[model samples]
Target chain A: MKTLIIIRERDYVWLRTVFPDIHPLLFPICNKPFIEFLIDFSILSGSEAVRIVSDGSLIDVEEYCDNGSLWGTAISYSSIMSMDDQRAVIEKNRRFCSEEKILIISGLVFIQYDKLHDYKSLFASQPNGDLLVCNGGSLSLTGNPPKLQKNSAPLSLSLIALDSLDGYYRLCMEILGFASSPYVLPGYNNEAYCHIGRNVVISKSAEIRKPVMIGNNVQILEDSIIGPGSVIGSNVIIDRKSTVTESIVLANTYIGEQLEVQNKIAAGNMLIEPEGGICITMDDPHLLTGIKKSGSVRSLLRFLVHSFAALLLITLQLIPFLILSPILTIQGKWKKSKNIYYTGTAGETLTLTTTTIERRGFISSLAAALSLDRFTLLFSVLRGRLAVIGSSLELASDSNTTLHEVESWYHAGVFSYAEAEEWPVSGGDKAIVERYFSVHGNPFLDITMTIKAFFNRIHETNTP
Target chain B: MIFHVDGSTGKKLGIAALNGRLDAKNSSELLTSFERWQQQTNLIILDCSKLDLIDSSGLGAVVSCLRKAIEKNGDLKLANLSPKVAMVFELTKAKKLFSIFTDTGSALQSF
Candidate 1:
């Protein structure tokens, strides 16, 4: 048997809105990406090959699953259009679906099946048709069964569409609530209702109330309570005195000290009450923030390199700044404004004396070209308030938007990586560029990018 | 934020209706408004039906208002909290501090 998993974008549009960064197939359910479950089920059904078709960009999914060697299943990915019907999808991949009996799992639906059960025989015995149908999608079989068993017990399986946040939350809780989960969950499980993954540091004073699934590199701090029912994803920190009961904390999220996080889904700095469908992007880092992996050794080196680079830039531009500043101020060409900007740390803000030069002449242009406008900000680098090259900083203003939303990779930088990459300064484009640098950055690479940014500013076309 | 005194309960009870959001921007405004409402009636019930969202600062402001009401030898209660706003209260453990009711009518009677 072969499997064809058709995941239309329209089926999981809500997931894109809620988790824009995550691929629909890679959306984590109980700390394991959603795609893994489909692969497992496809393998369980005695499938020799699996082809996943999606309308959206499958680059992330392809990159993650990568030939399906991890699961030892021969998995292939294909693209389909929104208008494409089930027949069209099958026709498009007819070569792959030609020989074998095809098991078609369409839409974003969860298959409730016990791993302990034998599905191969049941699938072989069943007639070629849809096994079950749900509101979101269906599980149908194509091609004739080689030899049907005379009398086969009914397929004890159910399908549920993960359409809404409430449905998704309920599904996770339902799985956890099970005395023995039908689906295979990640992490190490020795006891019932408890799964702890690698490098989990649970403090002596911390309390574990059971029915908890903790992922890799978690730190349950002193006096913290984890789970009565909870899922803590990889690289999570439950700070001292914080209680996470009936909640889902996604990977790389920091739950700040003395906070009570009950009945919610925390992804990085954003908190969502799934039952109510209320999502809150927290501005205060002291409450909740994203934890980027920067070792103390790496951070110290970065700080030193940034400080040194800042000093070099200041020394090089000091003469030009002094020569042009007085003339610009006299000509009323230099405009200074005090704006509050978020610092490198989450929730911390710093006031910068920002200067904008009205470039009508050589002196002003020279000042701008030498990047004199950023001179005041250079001092902040030495003080460890800003990055040498990081995310583009936005003003923390009291605007109409309650979404004081900053991405997890956000860091106020002396020079934005977007400028260095010569990328457009729009929010979406800037985020993509900055996110790349945030992950791929090293102390040495930062200095090179800083130089590129400085040169890039010289070519910056002034409106005046 | 709008404050109203419910006289139907045969006691002095203030009902404050919070609007759209009570975040960092307008949290202090809620605190200031709550102070004035306290002078009229120490028994207060925050009607949060229309309050769609709140942040840490806003949660702090509400907690502070409850503290002030207690210091004045009276009590503050919560009523008609929307599910979204209620999640914040539950997450922060602030629900434990206040006597919550289904509606302002019930909250006023409780006072």
Candidate 2:
């Protein structure tokens, strides 16, 4: 049998109001995407193929579900009008539903089923008219009802209305409490109830209770207690002596020391009462707060170290610069320009007199080989303006100024961090590498990386 | 949250109905009043049916209450767990430590 699941945008409008950034299709119910539950139910119902009909964009859903090969079913998608009724939806999808018996599931409802039941046979044997349905949506036959040799035992389907935050929380908790074993949930299910993710650091003094789902990069500090139904998202920090129970903490949240977080949703300084749909954005970091990555000290240290390294380079290249300066000044193969560029942290703009070695002839080649073109900028590092190794400085303009204002993880450097790693200084992967080292690296390591960047720059052929 | 003392089975059991959330803000309140609640009886039944959410701190307070009750040769059992709240207990494996029941009457009788 084939399945056609129809969900209108109006059915899930509550999700957009509550979580503005989250795509409705990606809304997790009990750690599983809302769409995945429908898919699971369809597959269990012995669907040979499944098509999801939605009036809204399915980019996020499509990105996550991706052909549904993992579930051993061919999944497809269709679009319908937001005002389309059940009959209109079926009629629209008539081409797909023409050949076989189609199981039409509608609405934003959850279908609860026993994992032990063989739903394949149950769905196969049932007479096709409204086999199982709830108040939210229905299951009925589109094409001619199939003739079965034997009648199947009927299974019930209830509408789990997930229209409110309270419902969402309750639904998640309900599933976590009982459906843990039966459902394939995200995270690592090592022990019975605890499902942990990668790079979780639990201090020895920290106590963890079971039936918890902890996401990646979680740090449970000393004397803290966790779980008995806690869902901690990625990049969460539960500070010392604090406890978390029966709550869903969204990603990048820091729980303060000795605080309590029971039965609430904490998302980046916003405390949400899911049931009542009330949200309070915290102003204080100690209460509940977003993760602020301040690389000021590290950036300062990198600047100091880079400057010292630059001084050494300047010393080595001084003779070469002296030799090339007069000749290049005569040749015009050397060019100079003055522009204000961003300096790390202080947000101070420095007017840098940039000298470019033109890739014209043998004279320019000799000057480039000696690395003499970088002589002027080395003084700016001496003045503690830029890091010797970091990201290439982008001037602050209205178009790209939003980057700095939005906390760009990239640090402006005399020598790009990507150059040190020999990575192309663009693309998402390069950003990840630069950010990884920028947050974790120290001054000594910076010096070594700067040296590598210098040699890399030497190997790089200078182009326009 | 609601609290009442019951002695129907000849055992003094304090039943506390947790409502909404039992997180950091009010977990200490629960912990602080636990002694006073324990003074009435050692046996306790925490009805979490109305508790919509909990966090690590709230879980700690509950565990701490259990420890305090056990110290006095008393037992604390939970009843009517909301799926969400019960999930925390099961995830932390704290469910193993308590003698949980479906309702307050069963917990009271068990005590």
| Top candidate (TM-score) | 1
Q: Which ten residues in a row have the lowest lDDT in candidate 2 chain A?
A: A401-410
Cα lDDT of model 1 by residue, B1-111, tens digit:
888887886887788898898889999998889888987999888888888888889989989998999899988888898866776677667788888888877887786
Q: Candidate 1 lDDT (Cα, whole model)?
A: 0.85
lDDT per residue as tens, model 1, A238-284: 99999999988999999988889988899888889888788877777
When candidate 1 is compared with the true two-chain complex, its DockQ is 0.44
Cα misplacement distance, residue A248 of candidate 2 (Å): 1.3
Model 2 per-residue lDDT tens digits across residues A106-219: 877777766566877766666767655666566665565546635546565556666678887887787777667656677888677778888999999999886788888889
lDDT of 2 by residue, B1-111 (tens): 678998788867799888888878999999978888888888888998888877767888999999999999998889998665665565445777888899887888886
Q: What is every candidate's C-alpha DockQ against the true complex, given to 2 decimals?
A: 0.44, 0.03
TM-score of chain B of 2: 0.94
